[model samples]
Target: MGGFKATLINEIEKLYKKKKIIVAAALALIFIIVGQLATIALRNGFGVRTVGSMEFPILVLSVVANTIIPLFAALITIDSFSGEFSQNTMKISLTRPVTRFKFFTAKLTAIILFVFLNLMFVMVFSVLAGLIFNSNTLTAYGIIRIFISYIVTIFPMIILVMMIIFFSNLINSGIGVFFLSIIVFLGFKVLGILFSDYSGIFFTSMLDWYNLWIMSVFPFIKILREFLLLCSYGIILFTGGFYLFDKKNF
Candidate 1:
């Protein structure tokens, strides 16, 4: 356990040295701020009704998910493995007195933690934006609902990160992982809808924020169930990524 902790610390240090966390944080801040600005515009400008209701929050969240969250997740994890391999540091990383599984898991854990923190920042900023745009007494339920809503908004992006990490190990380049992640996400949505005839309740349903918002469907129970399914998918992909990394000739 001590060894694993040491390895985790080392991986974190390496990440910091590369300014990966800093870059991710900066992007998160930018997205949150942009989301706030866009929300203000939507509420105040264009003669639209700025009623302090669930509709406003949902619209704002859709904007964030569609614009901000996707870019941040992609840039943060796009180079998950290729960055190491390209720099020829994979050899040094494997030389550490730690199991391959632990090393990969540590880095992935860091990225997920980063994503969660980014989500919190976005939620807080959105609330502040809400207050500034219109003076509504933020109710307890409102606060809780929007938080759940925004996190749920980013659920598909999180799954894409897992896919990126897994394929980053399989391919020789990070670009492949990045593009493949996008293709799988958007392509699956199209194919799932056009071919499989699957309903919007499935994981693919979450891919299109516009559809989710227009449907006016905030099925909390269903969202919770989908979140569990996403976590399960994440665990499976993470395990596969680890296995590939462990056996790869790197």
Candidate 2:
């Protein structure tokens, strides 16, 4: 148990040491800045007319957050496995005291933790900016709703990240995983819209879980149901990604 914990900790340290993670963190900060700026601009321009001034800002920020954060998450994970093989680190890491399953799980766990933390940070910062710009406090219930929606939205996003991590091992080229992830993300999204009738299967479009919040408009049982399903979808994709990853060989 002690050894396993140590190994996990080391894996986490390794993840943070990467330049890609640094770049991703920097990009998330940009998201924060842009979200804050956009909110302020929208409120000033709209100023409570047909829509609440805060409405456009929040909506635009949410759109940006939902669309962009997943790409960050995927880029973070893209190199996790593939990087090991490409850099020839696999020979050392896999030959260590830890089992391959444990190594993979630790990496996956770290990736998920990073994605969740980053996602929460961006959402919280955006809301804080919204508060600053609009002077409209998101009530406790509103905060809770937003928090739930953010978490649900990020689940599918992380699945996309995990899938990219799984692919990283196959490609095993520097920056290849990141580029491939972006391409797949954009392509799948297009496919999802072009084939809207079967959009549910594609994890990328599942970010629309936010629509449920608007659908219920007041947090009812139906919204709760949809939230559960959305969360389940994330779990399924994440676990399936791992299952495939475990079978992958260098």
Candidate 3:
């Protein structure tokens, strides 16, 4: 347990040292500010009142999930997994007393922590933006709903992380891993669009799970089904990554 904790700490420290978290936070802030400004313009200038400040976080999340999150996931996974191999640093860690499983767990935990922090920043910033611009009074219920939405968002993100990590474990080239993951993500999105009837099979479709929170009538069954699909994909990709990592030659 102590070894795993140490590894986790080391992984997180490395992420900070590399400025991954800093970059992510900056991007989140910029995207939120720009998106909120555009939304405000549309609402007041163009009379598109459908876009509210309260909905800012949701809009930012939906847009980032499709664009920024996937790219970040691929880059982070490649840096954590494949970049070490490319730089010959992975062998040093492999020679250490820590088990491969513990090392892998630490890296995965770090990635998830980074993503969670980014999500928190988006939510907090969105709330602040809403208050400043939209005169949105923060209510206890609104706060609870934001937290719930964050939790729901985690499901799809886990699947994305696992998928990228799976590719990273398979490919030693960091750039190759990144491009392959992006291609796969885009392919899944295309598949979802072309086969809307079978959208359940595409993990990309689950990325829009935020809609469940925004809907007037919550479709519990659809949410449950999408949640299950994400879990299934997450499990498969994680297992594949573990198997590949264990069998991989250092």
Q: Of the candidates shown, which would achieve the greatest lDDT relative to the real structure?
A: 3
The true-versus-predicted C-alpha distance at residue 39 of model 3, in Å, is 2.5
Question: For model 3, which pairs clash?
Answer: none
What does the lDDT read for residue 59 in candidate 3?
Answer: 70
Q: What is the C-alpha lDDT of each candidate?
A: 0.66, 0.66, 0.80
After superposition, the stretches of candidate 2 with alpha carbons farther than 4 Å from their true spots are: 1-3, 45-61, 64-67, 217-250
lDDT of 3 by residue, 204-239 (tens): 888777778757798989888887777788778888
Q: What is the lDDT of candidate 2?
A: 0.66
Q: How would the candidate models be sorted by TM-score, starting from the highest?
A: 3, 2, 1
Identify the leading candidate in terms of TM-score. Answer: 3
Clashes of each: 0, 0, 0
Candidates 1 and 3 compared by lDDT, better number = 3
TM-score per candidate: 0.77, 0.78, 0.92
Q: What lDDT tens digits, residue by residue, belong to model 1 across residues 86-167? A: 7787888788788887788777766665666666776666566667766565678666667666665556666666777888
* Model 2 agreement with the true structure over 154-212: per-residue lDDT tens digits: 56665666667656755657487777777888888899989998776666666676656
